[model samples]
Target: MTPPAPNIDPLTTPLERERVLAAYQRACAALEAAQQPNGAWAGEVVWNPMLICQYVICSHIVGREIPEPRKQRIRLSLELQRKRDGGWGMHPDVPPAPGDHDHHPNHDRDPAGLAGAHDSWMFHTVLGYVALRLLGADPNEPLLQDVRAWIHAHGGPYGVPTWGRAWLALLGLYPWSELQPLLPELWLLGDDSPMHPRRLYCHMRLIYLGLSYLYGARTQADASPLVEAIRGELYPEGWDVSRFRATRDQIASTDLYEPIGQSLEWLFAGARALSRAIPAVVRRRALARAWEHIEFEFASTNWVCLSPVNGMLFCLAMWSRDRRDPRLAQALQGLEYWMWEDDSEGLRICGARSDIWDTSFALQALCEGPQIDEAARAVDRASAWLPRAQLRADILGGREHYRESARGGWGFANEHHPWPVSDCTAEALEALLHAEHRGWDHAAARLDLSDKLAAVEFVLLRQNDDGGFGSYEPRRGSMLLARFNPAEMYGNCMLEYSYTECTASCVRGLAVALEALGANMPSELRARVQAGVDAGVQFLLGSQASNGAWPGFWGVNYTYGTFFSVAGLLAAGLDGEHVAVRRAVRHLISAQRDDGGWGERYEGVLESRERPLDADQPSRIVQTAWALLTLQQAAPERGREAIERGLRFLLDQQQPDGTWPHDAAVGVFFNTAVLDYRLYKLVFPTWALSRWLSR
Candidate 1:
């Protein structure tokens, strides 16, 4: 039997029970309306990683790590998803769990077999197995058994995923000839053209850049004994070593996120046919360029690299290039950042760090009122993360390394990416400054920087002359370039766009930076402030939909955006009493279901699905936080009773653990999928409840 989920249904007071039921009904109705075929349960997720992302996040916050054992359990879950027939699917019901392994799957005679029973791709299966294997599961483990059996049950190693083969090539399980070569030799090709790997999505480019160099020379490890053993079991007829060349271009339906353009395909085919010879000097130069990029990513990111997957692969890539490399050594040593541990699972790597991103607002919300106890607790967390997350060493590699100056910036989770994400740095700095204001000592010792204001200065540089903010970096490319997005499953990754949440965070950071600088701020600082305020109002006003909603680019939906945007507007001197503001407030009120609480489906975040919204969908704690914050900002005198009722709903919902239960996802990206901002459950309530206490 499976372990039971924690008790999530909190009991409520009499009045609060009625309120909770009403809100539950409201949100449930909304979700029911938003359902897709089967149980895909997509409310806001766009890139299709919503549920998977959530499982990773919730496990981290609760267990405080992604333990290897937990990862193995995830593998079991994925295995259970496979049908007896031999295929994987998007949802639980899609490719019904395999009914019988003995059943011969005849493709033409069995339409039902093809209906849901077919090998989708080995990529997801490979990822699932890797996660399980990392937990110490051997080749014979039930989960691996199902995966390997399914691979052979479908055909053989030749039926495996292209991406899976590529990863395995690095592991020495497969030869490089099987991969559609992402040649770093292409770096020898000029940069101005669209062929450069740097032109890909930030996430994808981060992975492929390191991979090309590693794959170009066909780097492979001394295969794990377990891996070699599994090679025999993974393929029937004893695994053909050369069949990969013929099947290299095979496309499994599930693996096709976007089709390669005919032009790019022709170029690749043409390259394969060509001699593909480059001058020895050019090869040296290209390898040098690749090394520079690899080192830059390592230095800027403190050898943490972008994601754990890439971070691990890049570690191997660096080792392949130079066996005695110090950068490679640092990456290996620092691998613990991604390695999470728990009692159930000994050790499992995290998707990324949560403590930094989670702890920031945790500190600020705790500081809002005079809850000195909670404030001190949050202070301790921020105190521990701050000094450690700072970049004390100079960067080592990349084009930006040769740029004018180093911006002492921070990443989303620690100093892992050192990429100087403008808002992340601003938010980190603000959190640190708040910690200082709350009387916490800077726990990170010997942390001195000549670049004291480098991060804030970076923020200033990022601010447009008109005064708006964008995520990651400035808006450097065209939005029209989205048409060329090869990752069909994703949207809006080609360039940065100004977002209200980012703008609010940046604006608030500036206010704190001004305070930190004291009267030493240039006279121009005052001018900049006014310019920011003016530009911010215009951005906020223009962004508001005709229906009086501000579509959230990041969070679950409009309610999240409205709360932050309205708070920023009010902070910037916009009067809620104004007719437009009043109408927006009323729209928020009218949209609220009979339930005293508010709940917006993730679809509302991704697609701007405003209502006549749903009732009977239980109101989530995070949504309640957003609504309460909005109500507080709107300061709707007549609506105080309703707002107070919503407060009771939250108070009643708090668990003995001092946390609320996870609800439906509350974040969206690429405007199609939802992500769980699980931290929102804790931080938003802490901030909201603190506001109520102050009241």
Candidate 2:
């Protein structure tokens, strides 16, 4: 049976206790109200306007017309994300500084006035201008005029980065010959070859799989007046392909996160020369091999591919081969799974769906809160939905296709989305364990013992030799492979290295399952779980920095990493007196803002270190919740005052309707794109407060 909820803290004043309970009630209500009809609590996975731009460009390449209504909505979305400098940025506008309530007002004003914001990538600006034009916006319109001037001032379209160049070249607005090559012949490399595409990270390799195929075919849309007009507009100076081709290596300063190094340049030159030397017969064979992989990817994910970025690329590749292929239509329809439409952002395709990820976390939060009885029906629905969302079988011929086994795991989005991630599986297993331990009424919906063991085995398989876990697969390529990284807009994307968050989640999940399974577990599985937990703990201990913070690869910064690390350690049976736990507690204590909350800037992600946000900067609800959750587990007695203050901050920040503000980006990836998960504000804080009350 589940343990009883802890008594209300004796030290809390009567008035404070009343406030806490009221706030808790409201937050629970808000969460319950937000549940979707399918029993999931999916938030919009907000990203940049680049997705909209790509969608428009892709529709043009495939000869699909955008309906007038959808086009207007896309235009509105572009207008909303435009910066004060009359350019589109790589991510949404950063929230304003403290005491600036109207910073992001509900009007045309650019709140941050961040004209030169780091997020103002030249690639996004170029895509935005072209997308607006394709959507039928007048060139002489004031917004278009301002955007055009911004483009010219930023060195025009020639300065766009490698991927941007590829997109433009595909649309016949730029020259393909001058762009850096993505050789499909690389796919012909043996499985054992170190440089094989299969050795790269799953997302990176899948994207290039489509890109290499298109590059080999020299795929370009048929020339149209729209393409010609956009071409002239992009290069206002002139459309001299040879003159602009010289600037192929010249990326805009704003968009260069990882410069193409000297070694990569040599490799590119060699690849260009090799492309010319390869026999025509060999080239045809390589393209056929590349197409085999593309077809396998489409079959694996039911034609969704991996992400919208690659999803678009694969659609273009399919059209180039055989426009009448029925699978091309299926692949195009699968892209709709990632789309999110709303009055505010209009019709935008998300980078990925968060249904399973969001629902798993939300379930755990509800189970932890004192109001579980009120949320019982919601819990029952979510609990029932989670098991259905689990990937029940491995992808057939997964090894041949370079896929890790997905059986007993959950993908980030939903079951049909076949790329199951380590952290997502761990978190989902932990949530189910919480529900089962509570003896929830949905008995028939519960996963069987075999299912639970399969999940544990799945996570166990993801553990690297170093004892840490990677996101999708074990580390396949060397860190030295990073030198060959071609995606300038991203970082650490060439290989799947072990991440602190993934390791911590796996540790905690395995620990909980070990206890929950009790005598029903097999002895062999138990031994493996114990060994995995011990090694994972050692990895966490070894990875902690001198200041006791761990770098967060998935979330905003150190606060996220430290929170998961501390929780994992405690769950692995470490006490508050453990040196790692104490150091982590102290780190959180030092980072606490004067207002009693916590905040971290996205810039810290770029620095690959924990640079605490300035004290005067606005604190974030999600970070504050993370801090409170960590402090309560790791230093409840030593950091009592800090805990109480954090609780108060959360309580005060709660709105009359029960939710806290999503003040900043909480999720991050590739050290660049910052993500705003909309449900984060409601989920984390409610979890924190519930734990505080229970404690």
Estimate TM-scores for all models. Answer: 0.72, 0.96
Error of 2 at 14 (Å): 3.3
Off by over 4 Å in 2: 1-4, 95-119
Error of 1 at 685 (Å): 0.9
Q: Give the per-residue lDDT of model 1 (tens digit) for 1-695.
A: 01111122243346654544343333223322322232111121112212232334222212225545556555444444454444443322223344332232221222111343343445545544543453456877565677667666545545444445666665555677656656677665555655555545456566666677776656765555655665566554665656777766554455444455566556556655542565566656766787777777776667676666566656666767776665555776556565544443223344545444555565555455443443454455445556566554445434552221235666566545554556666666676676565556355532243334565666665665446787655554445555544343345655567887878667767666666656666667557765765686778777777777677887756787777677666656667785556766876776665666777654354345763234445676787888787775677465577677777777777665456665555665666434555456666765666554444
Candidate with maximal lDDT = 2
Candidate 1 lowest-lDDT run of ten: 39-48
Cα-lDDT of candidate 2: 0.84
User: Which candidate achieves the best TM-score against the true structure?
Assistant: 2
- Model 2: weakest 10-residue lDDT segment is 95-104
